[model samples]
Every structure is written in structure tokens, then in C-alpha cells.
Target: MTLKVGTILEGTVVNITNFGAFVDVEGKTGLVHISEVADTYVKDIRQHLKEKDKVKVKIIAIDEQGKISLSIRQAMPKSSRPVEIDWQGERNKNSGLSFEERLAKFLKESEERIQDLKHREGRRYGTASRR
Candidate 1:
């Protein structure tokens, strides 16, 4: 099969390293970088992939040197992917508030958070100075 960018293919994990995993797809080996292994952060590649594990990978890039870059996260079907929450849309849905009102509320909450943080920092330094 011709490997093109955006092509999703099933592959076997031939090897795993600290940086990424080598996958064999249709007789060609591709590198699935650690960041491309999952939608969430992967602290250790071994936690997500193991040698001989079958994985579906999307062809993200093909370098001039013929190196293929694959992504397991992108290969996943959209139905199985996490739905992105629109914070503003959700807030407006329930509150029925205008944009200006939302903006004012957000500013108030932000200022309150900043003041709370400043108070906590002051307390920490105040106690530390006495030691």
C-alpha cells in the first residue's frame, strides 16, 4: 500500500524507546513519537505501548529522508475521542446572559482569584520572615 500523509494504517510495535516507538506497517517502519502516542500526556512510552502490540497509526509526515512520522492519537476514530467542552457556550446556555455580563463576571472572578493568591503569598512570606 502507498503510504501517504493522513493515511491510517494498522501496524505492529516492533520496538519501544524512551523517546518513541518503532512500528512496522506494510513492511515499512515508522516512528510514533511519545507525544503522538495518546491524547493525554505520556510520561512513559511503555505505559501506552509494548513490543508486538497492534496499533492504528495515522501518517502525519514523511520527511525528505523517507522517514515516516506516525500518530496513534490521530488514528483513533472521532466517535471514541473526547468531546471538547466550550466553557463560554456552556455558561451562557444556563445563565442566558449577554456577552457584556459574562465579561464582567469573568473579570470579577479573576480579580478575586488574584487577590486570594496575593493573600496566600503574603501569609507565606510573613511566616517565613519570623524564622
Candidate 2:
């Protein structure tokens, strides 16, 4: 029943402000910061939330004075979560290239790409005069 940081709870919206919304969750209360309300820009808090509205919020901060700050952003559905990019195509787990070596390889590849684009078909480096 005690509110704790990182705890997720269902709450009712008691008030809505330009900055954020206030919710009372599990007999405890907290404020959902404006920046933490949603993933996209919110020009008006009322557009997305309203008084007496039900929402799920995640407790993010609990001050020594028991002040609780919450985030509805953290409770966003997984479908709206950030997509993690896999770099496995760049290197395997056992690749031994050092940082400097990898940088050098990257530079070499970039230079080749630029050269390829700059030159016309079959007019590559050292082959300008040839057919």
C-alpha cells in the first residue's frame, strides 16, 4: 500500500494542468511530469488526459519528504517502445578488430564508395585511358 519509486500503479486523474496531470494511485498521490506524460510533444495536457480519467503510471521519484513523481511515459505499450538496432551485421561476437583498426576500415570503405560514385562505369582509378 506504501508508494515506492519504480512501482507501477493504476490511478485516477484528479486534476489536469498545462504542465502535467495529478493522479492518486493506491492511496498515494503523485504528479506526472509534462515531459513524462507521453512520447510525442503535448501542446496541451488536457488533450491527452482529463480529470477522473484512469491511467497507469510508473513511480519514478520518491523524495525523503515522501514526494512522489510519476511517469505515464514509462508505462507506454511495448508497441510504442523504441526499436533496438542489432549490430550483428557489422561484427560477430568473436571479431578481433581494435578501435583504431575498425576506424581505419570504415574510412577505407567510405573512400571507395565515394570514388565509385565519382567515376563513371569502367572509368575507375588507373583505368581512365583504357576501354
Candidate 3:
């Protein structure tokens, strides 16, 4: 099969290293970097992949030297991806409130947070101060 950029294929994990995992795709080996292993932060690639494990990977890049960069996360179907939060939609849900009302609410919440932080700090270090 002609493996081009954006091509998705199933491969076997031939090796695992601290930096990345090597996958054997149709007899060709490609490097799936630790960042490409998952959508979230990957502290350790071993936790997500193991030698001989079958994984679907996307051909993300191919350098002139013929080195292939793959991504297991990108190969996943769009429906399986995490749902994004719509900040605008959430804000619009409370559209009935006026601009001044929103500003007042925001100021009240901010002041309350500041007061809470100060209270916590006072408790942890005591209100007494040294000269």
C-alpha cells in the first residue's frame, strides 16, 4: 500500500522507547511520537502502548530522508473524540440578563473569590505580622 500523509493503517508496535513507539505498518516501520500516542498528556508511552500491540495510526509526516511520523490519536474516528465545550453557547444560555447585570454579577463573584483566598491565606500563616 502507498503510505502517504493522512493515510490511516493498522500496525503492530514493534518497539517502545522513552520518546516514542515504532509501529510496523505493512512491513514499513514508522515512529509514533509520545505526543501522538494519545489526545491527552502522556507522561509515559508504555502506559498506552506495548510491544506487539495492534494500533491504528495516521501517517502525519514523511521527511525527505524517508522517516515516517505517525499518530495513533489522529487515526481515531471523529465521533470517538472528546466533545468540545461551547463557551459562547453557555454565555448565550443566560442571554436574558443585561450587560450591566452581567458586569455586576462578575464583580460580585470576583470579590467573593478574593475574600475567600485572603481568608485561607490568613488561616494558614496567621494574621500576625513580624516587624
- lDDT (C-alpha, whole model) for all candidates: 0.93, 0.86, 0.93
- Predicted candidate 2 versus true structure: per-residue lDDT over 72-122, tens digit per residue: 999877888878778995587527888898889889999999877766544
- Index of the highest-TM-score prediction: 3
Q: Predicted candidate 3: what Cα RMSD to the true structure?
A: 4.7
TM-score of 3: 0.74
Alpha carbon lDDT at 25, candidate 2 = 91
Model 1 CA lDDT for position 34: 96
Clashing pairs in 1: none
RMSD of each: 5.7, 5.3, 4.7
- Predicted candidate 1 versus true structure: per-residue lDDT over 1-131, tens digit per residue: 79999999999999999999999999999999999999899999998999999999999999999999999999999988999788988766748778788899889999999988887897888842344
User: Between candidates 1 and 2, which one is better according to lDDT?
Assistant: 1
> What's model 2's lDDT at 46?
85
Candidate 1's TM-score = 0.69
Which ranges of candidate 2 are over 4 A from the true structure?
77-79, 93-105, 112-131
Task: List residue ranges in candidate 3 displaced over 4 A.
Answer: 94-98, 109-131
Candidate 3 residue lDDT tens string, 46-77: 99999999999999999999999999999999
